[model samples]
Target: MYRVSLFPTRDLHLSDLRVALINYICAKQTGKHLIVRVEDGDKAHNIDGKDQELLDIIALFGISYSHLYYQSDNFKYHLQFASTLLDRKKAFICFCPDEKATPYDGRCEHLSPDEVLNNPNPFVIRMKTEPISDSFVIMARNKYPTYTFACAFDDMLQGVSTIIQDEAYLENSSKEELIRHAIGYDQAISYTHLPTVHESEKSVQWLLDQGYMPEAIANYLLLLSTPTPTEIFTLEEALSWFDIATISKDSVHFDMEKLGFINREHIKKLSDMELSKRIGYACENIGKLAKLYTKEVSTTLEIKQKIDVIFAKKEPLATFEAESKLLQELIFNAPYFEMFDEFQAYLLEKSNLHDEAFFKPLHFWLSGSVQGLELALMYPLIKNYLKEIVR
Candidate 1:
């Protein structure tokens, strides 16, 4: 059993998705139950409808939870456990007025229960910590339990066996462990703190806006932790190779270059029809371009731009002078090949002149770009562009 907490702040980011994905993978591979807990106990920071938005985001990534819970739902139990500590003389009510005080001095530790009940002042509950240790406050005067108290109590009550979180929370593990011991819970939940994703200037929304695929994002995230030899892979293939023990403890830096490379690889995997559908979502012209090229394109904008180049009213670039003879020959033998196989045989017959030097200028004239789809596939598109230009 594992429990992962998501705060569902108003401005959600990629880091939230990264944490959720790691936890989901861990639970799935280990055959353990996973609970997604919305940490809404701190109502002061909670936003309206943010919880449902968080759920929507989780579903967007195709992650599923065995159980869903809200920390606020167990508020009564949190307070009860804090009170239990008081009854067992493990904690006391501090009447101190200073809000900035740290390592509480236990000023009200000697106050009797009757005195605490009768003398009601704005007070906070402080754990009666031992010497060589600083006292910590678990509940404020407003009766709202601190994050540490609520998290620990609920983890125990909910039978959570493992806790997965970012490295920033490693400091709080000790505080939570103390609360667990104070509450008389013997079994300690295993802690696994995954390395944090270095803060990126580009937010998650920005990446999506730039036409990145979700699969590529997930693949890039996994590659940051695991040493996958290949640039592209499906989530199922990645899960088969995922091992929590192999995750690097050092923080992972977000590399946009690597992400773009992975995205290109994923784009290449899509069938032409599927690629057209995705392009159509962006622009119908791009979808028609996909049908014209009959090959994979890295982005919708790329295909659209290529189509514009082919349909430009201006003549092809003057740089095609070196291939002028080849161009005239291809035009004169206009209907040389109706099928790609016949074209390949024709190229094989002129193997000596079919090298990169011969093809490079031809590609430049046809696509306005030096690099593009294979000649076998691009032949038809180039012929069509030539016919339009001649007319």
Candidate 2:
């Protein structure tokens, strides 16, 4: 059994990434119980609907977690631990207001519990940390021994043997280890921090604001930590791939081009039948999105119907921009390819060139894009659509 704990933040991208790692791990090691502990001590971090949504999304990826532990459920325990440390003189309730407390001040550690309780100003609990030794590691900004004292204790109590997290949190590993030592619960857990998600600056900012499909985001996260793209062959793929030892401590930038490339690969992996379903889904989604597009664009289902034919590879149509000047000139004289002879003659004349070369002129006049579905399919769809246009 391996205990894993995390503070599930609202960044769906990271949450999904962690889920993917966990699922991958379980699949690789059959029959190992993976426990999930949610760190919700900071009431400020609690989101109303997001936590459940995150759990559901993670489940969608197939990581079987044996127990879901909520740190909030143990707040009384945290307070109790605080009291123990206080009794042992290892911690104290600090009367120092947050604004006035600093590493230099150390005001809280020196105060008596009675003085702290009686003073009753805005205060918080503080650990009585030992002076910096060569052993101390800087986990984050200011200079506590790291992982905050409370976080390490919980990791011990929960028996977390390993942690797979984002690279941004690597240094926290050492600090956490140190805190475990201070509390004398000191068995070590392996740490693997994966790279951060990367995307183009503009797209990243936009995704941050508008959000993305939960499935797609989760899929993308799996891509981030998996050994290879092929590792995600099926839903079962998620449970078998977690290995904390392999995660790199580097920030993974969210690259749009890379994402587009991955999207295309994912698109290709769908079976033709699945593609048909996705085409339908895309149509529905596009219909909703049409309201946001420029009015000049057609909002009719008819256009979507025409476009989906291309996606299905049934009567695919190359965009008009793809057509060559010469092909465009040839197509300009006549519209529609009803006669096999005319279509054959056109293909024969363009035979000297590549298939893309043949479609250039025709594509230019029809779809207005340079490249897309096959000519065999596209030629007929556009011809049929144009005939409709004329009628």
Report the number of the highest-TM-score candidate: 1
- lDDT tens readout by residue for model 2, 225-282: 4564462244445445545456555566664544444444444454544433433544
Q: What lDDT would candidate 1 get against the real structure?
A: 0.71
Cα lDDT, all candidates: 0.71, 0.49
In angstroms, give how far residue 284 of model 1 lies from its true place.
Answer: 12
lDDT of 1 by residue, 1-391 (tens): 8876878565455666777777888888989998989999778878888888778766766778999999989999988888899888888888889633876566777987788888857988887777613777889888988888888888988899888788888877888999899877999689988787785767554676576767777778878777775758876676676777788888788888778777777766766556657655343333444654425545445555666664454343355554544553554355657676676466445533556555665555455565776655655544544555433
Candidate number achieving the greatest lDDT relative to the actual structure: 1
Error of 1 at 274 (Å): 3.0
RMSD of each: 6.9, 9.2
